[model samples]
Target: MAEAGLRFGIQLPVQSQSTIYCEHWETEAGPAELAQAAQAADRLGYAYVACCDHVAIPRRLAGAMGATWYDPVSTLGWLAALTTRTRLLSHVAVAPLRHPLLSAKQYATLDLLSGGRLLLGVGAGHVPEEFEALGVDFHRRGAILDETVQALATALTDEYPEHPGPRFPFSGLAVSPRPVQRPRPPIWVGGSSPAAVRRAARLGEGWLSQGDRVGDLSAQLRLIADVREQSGRSGPFAVNAIPPALYVGEPGWDTGRHALTGKPERLAEALSAYGALGVTHLQLRPRSRSLAEYLEQLEAVATDVLPLVRS
Candidate 1:
């Protein structure tokens, strides 16, 4: 049912094509192209479709970022109307930028409207300029993020939520459109910093690895295991891995030397290594030059690869 043993999801291509993970085709992409890709993923049985969050890019980082981030809330909401089963995720929303009540209202509406399919992944944001422009102190972001997660957990779960924190204090006000999911959606914590890992261990339903390699993932998994055990946390916890750039099948051109290219079974064999190391989910990407090519890759993974891994 779950592609054998592990659950897999993709960060939809056009939403936040940062240069680090951007494909050549994304530069030429627009809303139509994005909708097509998101719909295809839904059809192909991906466990979830993840969107990224970033308010603005500083001039210094714009070149590297490609300046093409669509707001996660708007993008996810747009695509949610088009798909049925697959869950929607903010791969890592910057919760510190906005008050938790606002975040709760927006995402709770998303969950309510999307038939309760929402996983609210959150993170400590990294951009100095973005935080400065929003009037939040950058150096205090880690603490702020911790508090934000606590606040969001409360606000998302209760019909009439209250948050009493140094930055935000409120009560006696009711937030409407309670999430369709009873207690609230799952909160997966993101980032690879030491602080982030601890927060996830202590607070999150899952850990979203930012940029850790396979070797790094194994170590991170071990560390998380230790942290959870040490803290005596008994709730459900998940470990995520973003593998090397994947090429689902033989390619006519060089996508890159690091690309995992070969038969689907071969690729599954490589990916199973991550599963063996206790990773419960993977956020995979494919190398492609067009939406058609990308969808083909998705189809191949769904058809040819996943079953073999399960076997």
Candidate 2:
């Protein structure tokens, strides 16, 4: 049902260990494991390898959202050196947490160092405490994110970019080592809220859904289309989805009832449904017990499932 072939990518583990998605093995893993995962993604022809971002985690939420979030800029910058072709993605950096210029400087250098393989995924962060700590108003994060996205577009595109705004206003200052991507690297807005989707349509090159149910995607896509039409924006806009955790074949251990498990053909048939819903790319998390098992699953996806996805 896909209008075109669907692309696949992975959100690198051992970085951010949220109770909702983190596998048991990731807790014991470290940088070596992270590098291997990125390397495998690169060798296996994945579209990108994603990293999460969080400046700090309040103790109240630390138990659930562990404080293990590796800085996306630092982590992705390191992974960039290890992988050859896989694009580096900040799964949703809370850009409003810092000044737009600082964000621009960090990402611009990353794009330059990575030879232009950067996907700047931005989001309005959820934690109120984090905003307070950073001197950013939690309630105004959405508006700040909008302005930040616009500022980033200009900053990444021009060495002496200027933008006058209520939140961030600057001119005449120059940032060196501009992003290698012409007109700037793709900015993918993340979140499933109505405001988030509208921002993506208006400002972003793509939309990164935050675990929206498959049943909800059609409505979201329609909303994106409506907003884009209203805004008179037209161009290539990627639609991304994070499907349920996947396992290529029958799992030896319990992968839970929600996981998509079975033979490659069955898995492909299930995954291809997202394409029918207008998802251009998928961010997959494979269910596994260890790094070895994780790599095996990635191999299975690349070899057994990927070939049959479009067929």
Candidate 3:
């Protein structure tokens, strides 16, 4: 059964062109198409619209990951100006690559400007070469990410934040334009590893799973619950899932066997299963051949699929 109030959001296309998921049509699409999709999400009552981050891609991995990765902070800032209601998300900003204060300065300004709508999804980055290029220790990324999250919590909440960490330490420094969200915007930890799950439980306001299978998520959820309970943390924590590639109604083209296709009710039933797994937020990727078809998919999700899921 679908959990009551299971919220959904889309990963805005044309921002990252990873060969793993990017449609052929997205190759020809650009900013105007991106804006239109975001605006539609805003108008249609999606909870958030998310963008991915990558400082730069090496030629070695460029064939698969692509080279069109947009800076999440800049893209989200632009989306903030374009939409009024929908929250802005980084999907997973690699925080360890940059100092927490620098991130805090940029994100705090974004939250203030966006009227308190920011979900800072952070991850310990995977690409070692990118880390090397930026002078961040690739092997120590997990530890660095842990400290970075702690520092970000303090920096986002306090104008004059202090951190005694070894790698990035500072005190008595003030960052102006405090965030609109009280005490700071929500930080969502992203990744599916054991350490990442624990990090999300201990520090994040939410957990953004990196495409973990539905069958695998229950164990992870149990792990999160155990960690939070042991740590004596008490508050609402958002649990997220990314469902199979979605295409509302029957697709005239191949959507692959992994995709959830057909009528609104069928799609709703499958999606609502995430809610049953204790997932509170869903990241949806709609398959399309062109910009018009993409918009149509979004519309179908909002008008037909969401209502059934909600009910």
Estimate every model's Cα lDDT from 0 to 1: 0.85, 0.92, 0.92
Residue-pair clashes, model 1: 0
Least well predicted 10-residue stretch by lDDT in candidate 3? 1-10
Superposed Cα RMSD, model 2? 1.4
Which regions of candidate 1 deviate over 4 angstroms? 1-4
lDDT of 2: 0.92
Per-residue CA lDDT of model 2 for 1-311, tens digit only, reads: 12256899999989999988899999999999999999999999999999998989999999999989999999999999998899999999999998999999999999999999999999999999999998999999999999999999989988998999877899999988889999899899999999999999899989999988889999999999988899988878898899999999889899988899999999999888988889999999999999999999999999999889977
Give the lowest summed-lDDT range of ten residues in model 2.
1-10
In candidate 2, how many Å is residue 171 off? 0.4
Off by over 4 Å in 3: 1-4
Best of the two (1, 2) by TM-score: 2
Error of 2 at 77 (Å): 0.7
Candidate 3 residue pairs in backbone clash: none
Q: Which stretches of candidate 2 lie over 4 Å from their true place?
A: 1-4
